[model samples]
Target: MAGVYDFTAKSLAGEDMALKRFEGQVLLIANTASACGFTPQYRGLEALHQALGPRGFSVLGFPCNQFGGQEPGDAKQIEEFCASNYAITFPMFAKIDVNGNNAHPLFNYLTNQKYGLLGRSIKWNFTKFLVDRSGKVVARHAPTAKPEALFREIEALL
Candidate 1:
């Protein structure tokens, strides 16, 4: 019964972060890209973080370049883009593969917990997973699913 808390990943700042630190908090875990059509969703995700963060909610963004090579920047570049463009205050992690053999362990666990419309592999960037306070994958949101659409579910978990 491995939960999300059982994982660890490197942050955009290059620090090892244990997912257990987020235990008991509702999480919106999204695989992000800087140059995609859905890149603008960062703003909405920031808004969600601002609105619900104090109520035990957090949005964790993981930059992924697997899709169209849209996120081909290094960690520093990604951090600067997110800060300058979206003023994103939420946590963003290092770039990692979201599919294929070299996928990050956290993502591997996530997809195993809940499949997307296209099946086990993530169809595109910005694919989101909503995790409850107990670290269970509660819902899987497609890349097209707007950040605002997750408010009700987040509120319920809060």
Candidate 2:
């Protein structure tokens, strides 16, 4: 019966962050990459964070290099890239695998709560999991599903 609140992950700053901190907030948890074709989605994701943050919603980005080695940068580099390019103000986590045996536990829990077209395994960068205020996984979005396209669903949850 564990929910998203039960997991912890390292922040991009290298500090352990308990997911419980976001317990009552609606969340869009995405496996992100700096060099992927969808990297531009960061802007939309940031917009969502800024626009809905005051309403108890947030976006959590987790950098992953498993897809085409697109996000090979170290923590500092990743932080710099996001700030310079997207002005990303949302919380971002340190680089971690999003598939196979080494996938982060948070991601494992996310994928388990909602299966994608490829089953529980993540198929690419930008795969997103939406969690409601109660920490229940509500939907799973594909890499092709732009962040902006999720606004309606997110708003409803809020």
Candidate 3:
């Protein structure tokens, strides 16, 4: 996939959600882990989503346990954690492997479009990809990068 709209992903409900749902919008696609040091970024993400969502921008959170198995919970548990802890309102997808041969195709496409500090492979959970309204991956952010730090580019897209 060359752009966010070029892909589809399983929602927490296990239903196929087309990336086209975000057409003409800026999207922040992130691989998250409840136990990762960057887990707290969820708050910032939620803030961004709420603040910019009305302006045609969104944040999509995908849980991944591949890195050190940081996100080991099932769907329900993950949902509970995100709600109770971070009050996350953005969409969250099922657990996916973000590394190795079993990596999700969407992530594979994202990494190729925007390499991280560690190159194509994502270094850890919370790594983020910014997709412009055209669906193309525009930037790759390290796990430590704060969500608030991305507002400028996201606004530019909007």
Candidate 4:
């Protein structure tokens, strides 16, 4: 029963934040990178966030550098790039691991609840976890899965 609501994580600003705050909202929690091909997915994610945020949907971005050092910039640089390019206004968290012993607790719990097509371990950057209103991990979207493909699932949960 250790779900997403049972965890806390650092924000992009480095403040501790309880995941419980997002307990009753539909969420698209993604592990992101600044220099990867899927980096452009931020636009789509922002689009989704803007379109559905008022309806209780959110896209939470977590910057990760584990895959080929794609998100190596400091938080400032990451912010500049995201804001300047995609105009993303959703929540963005500090850089963290998505797999292995040091993976972020929320992500560890998420991948445990919903494994990917290849398996449980995260394969690359931009992997997304969809969480329902009750803090349950509802689905896992791969790197190639566009943000638009997630609308139906999000709508169902909303």
Q: Candidate 1, residues 1-158: lDDT per residue as tens digits?
A: 77899989999989999989999999999999999999999988999999999999999999999999999999999999999999999999999998999999999999999998878999999999999999989999999999998899889999
* All candidates in order of lDDT, best leading: 1, 2, 4, 3
Clashing pairs in 3: 3-135, 4-135
- What does the lDDT come to for candidate 2? 0.95
Writing each residue's lDDT as its tens digit, candidate 3 over 1-158 gives: 25668788888878899988888888899999899889999999999999999998889999999888889999999999999999999999988888889999899899888887888999998899998887878899998889999988789888
Instruction: Give all TM-scores, in the order shown.
Output: 0.98, 0.98, 0.96, 0.96
Candidate 4 on 1-158: residue-level lDDT in tens?
68787888888888998888887899999999999999999988998999999999889999999999999898889988999988989989889999899998888888889988767899899999998888878789899999988888788888
Instruction: For each candidate in the order shown, give its overall lDDT on alpha carbons.
Output: 0.95, 0.95, 0.89, 0.90
| Residue pairs in clash, model 4 | none
Where does candidate 2 stray beyond 4 Å? none
Prediction RMSDs, each to the true structure: 0.6, 0.6, 1.1, 0.9
1-158, model 2: which lDDT tens digit per residue? 78899999999999999999998999999999999999999999999999999999999999999999999899999999999999999999999998889989888898988999999999999999999999999999999999999999999999
Clashing pairs in 1: none
